[model samples]
Target: MAASAEKLLNLLLRHGSLSRADLAKAMHLSRPAVSGLVDGLIRQGVLRETGCGASNGGKPPIMLEPVAERFGTIGVDIGHETLLRGVLCDASGKQLAVMELPHGNTFESISEQALKLAASLKAAASIPVAGFGVAVAGQVDHAANEIVYCANFPLKNRGLAERLAAGSGLTVRLDNRARAAAQWEYYFGAADNAEDFIFISAERGIGTAIYLDGKLFSGRAGVAGEIRSLLLPSPDGIGLLPVEQAMSEKFLLELSGNCPDTAGLVTAWRRGEPGAVRTVDYLIGGTVYVTGLLTNLLDPALIVLGGRFRDLGPEFARELATRLKVDPPRQLEFRLSKSGRIGAALGAALGVILENCKSNEP
Candidate 1:
């Protein structure tokens, strides 16, 4: 696969289907070169002819698209304390299947459960599984393919990727759940055209994935977006609290006193209960502060909000917008993630697909 061919594949994936002439024009290559790339991709099972496209005047041109059923990848999102979700997707990042299981207590047990789930999905897949992408709620050593530390879960220093690859017989890529979700957004969601943005995941904890200049910025230690480490001044001037401790779902629930879950808290807030109102205000203020900070630093085009906060809908969006005042030169847009609850899992699968696409390039 030449660089031109890879570019063509990416274009087709983004646009669904395109004619050879379209590919040629997009890549600024000659018609013969585009033809050769298309033929090679078709022969390699990476792409297939998808009927014909409407022509301006002459005969309809043949259109090419990714072979959706020829290659696939699996994604597993390990939660901090609840469920383990998985998704199986094709080369084009279309979901084929999804499953969930309760989180296991130990690393070995969790690994076994995840492997079994992946194996089951693989057994049912029509195409070959390219690899597996695991999204964990923790700091990851991408270079070492290891889970360096997970504050909310018990997976420190675990060769989790190695175990998954060995057990499932497929390549594995492990990453922080927020980073994986950001990748998914960049490649397949509303941020497809965006080169710079912030993906904030506010669930049991607050984590972020930063994209700048069309690349995921992992920083020096792969902990660049770990908001839990942020030590902000307390409102009372008594002490400081980590961002995660101050605004996460778990903390909010604690603040609610009687609310056992997010739903209850939401109800209390709607009812304007004093405790619930105070907690909601605090969370909103914290969120606005972080968004403003990021905006000042990165001047991103978009900010994608994910995790539990996603359910807040328009009210949260409006409040956030009112509070955040960007510089005159920067026009920022904010929206809830369309990836839904399975974003991390879907992102993991898409990461594998993207890596596979790159690997196929010559």
Candidate 2:
């Protein structure tokens, strides 16, 4: 598992299949070096000879592909409310099994629930389970395998990854839910070809995840995407408001006064109810402002809107684009996340799969 071998395998995984000549050209290595690596991989059962590539008036080259069914990983998303969602995925990121467990309030209870669910998923997986990844709704101290702080659940200072690994007997990785969702989208969702983009997770709170140059741009403290702290002008004419206070589901419901849920507010707005319509308009304005600022600063090629925005439907994206005030040249693509609520969970699984693969490299 030399670095060259790992690169060859990764290229095959990304491109589906490749000939030794293609791998040598991509890795700037000689054919003999790539041939050695490929031979080793084939012997290890990690890769297989798929078929033959069309030749340039020479012997047809053998194409190679990763053995997708040889390895799998478990992903768990710890939600803000009371549900812990889990998924089992192969190395190629295909879902094998999915389950949801009722989450407990305390750290011990939640850890136990996730462990149980993960165990079940591992039992159901057809391939060998490499590890587990947990996506939490707040800050994660990945090195320590702990949740630094999370508003949705009382999990501050909890050694979540360590406990889960100990309980389930697997390697574990943890990350912020928004960041994990961004990873999922970049690898398997709408942003597959995008190297730079912004992911806005408008759930119980407003969270942003930045990707730059094909990497997740986690700032010094990994709090780079906490958009909830972004302060903007308030519609009430009282004072400035934080992005979360102005656009979150709870705040929007409060603004509408009579709506008990997002569905109710959507219904009211559809019926031309003044309060609901006004609140929706205000939220849209705030979103436009935030997106405009981000476009000017980052200039990403795409912006993915997820969580509650998905619940708001297609009209929100259309309105946000129409209302955006960025320069014409800076206009960017906006997409609603196709992964929906399970994105974070899938991302967690992807993370573990990647970690295991990387760790296996020499």
lDDT of each: 0.82, 0.83
Evaluated against the true structure, the overall lDDT of model 2 is: 0.83
Q: Using Cα atoms with residue i matched to residue i, what is each candidate's TM-score against the true structure?
A: 0.91, 0.89
- TM-score of candidate 2 against the unseen true structure: 0.89
| lDDT (Cα, tens digit) per residue for candidate 1, span 1-362 | 45666677777776788999998888888999888888877888888888988989999999888989878899998864677889999988898999887766588778988998898788879888989999988888877988988887778887888888999989999888999988888877857788899999876567799999878999998887666777765645578888888876777888777888877888888899988888777778888888888889888989898887777666777788777887765678888888877899998898787777765642
What is the C-alpha lDDT profile of model 2 across 295-346, one tens digit per residue?
8888899889888776677887888877887776665888989888888899
Q: Which stretches of candidate 1 lie over 4 Å from their true place?
A: 54-61, 233-237
Output the number of the lDDT-best candidate.
2
C-alpha lDDT of residue 269 in model 1: 84
Error of 1 at 114 (Å): 1.2
* Clashes (N, CA, C under 3 Å) per candidate: 0, 0
TM-score computed on alpha carbons, candidate 1: 0.91
Residue 102 lDDT in candidate 1: 74
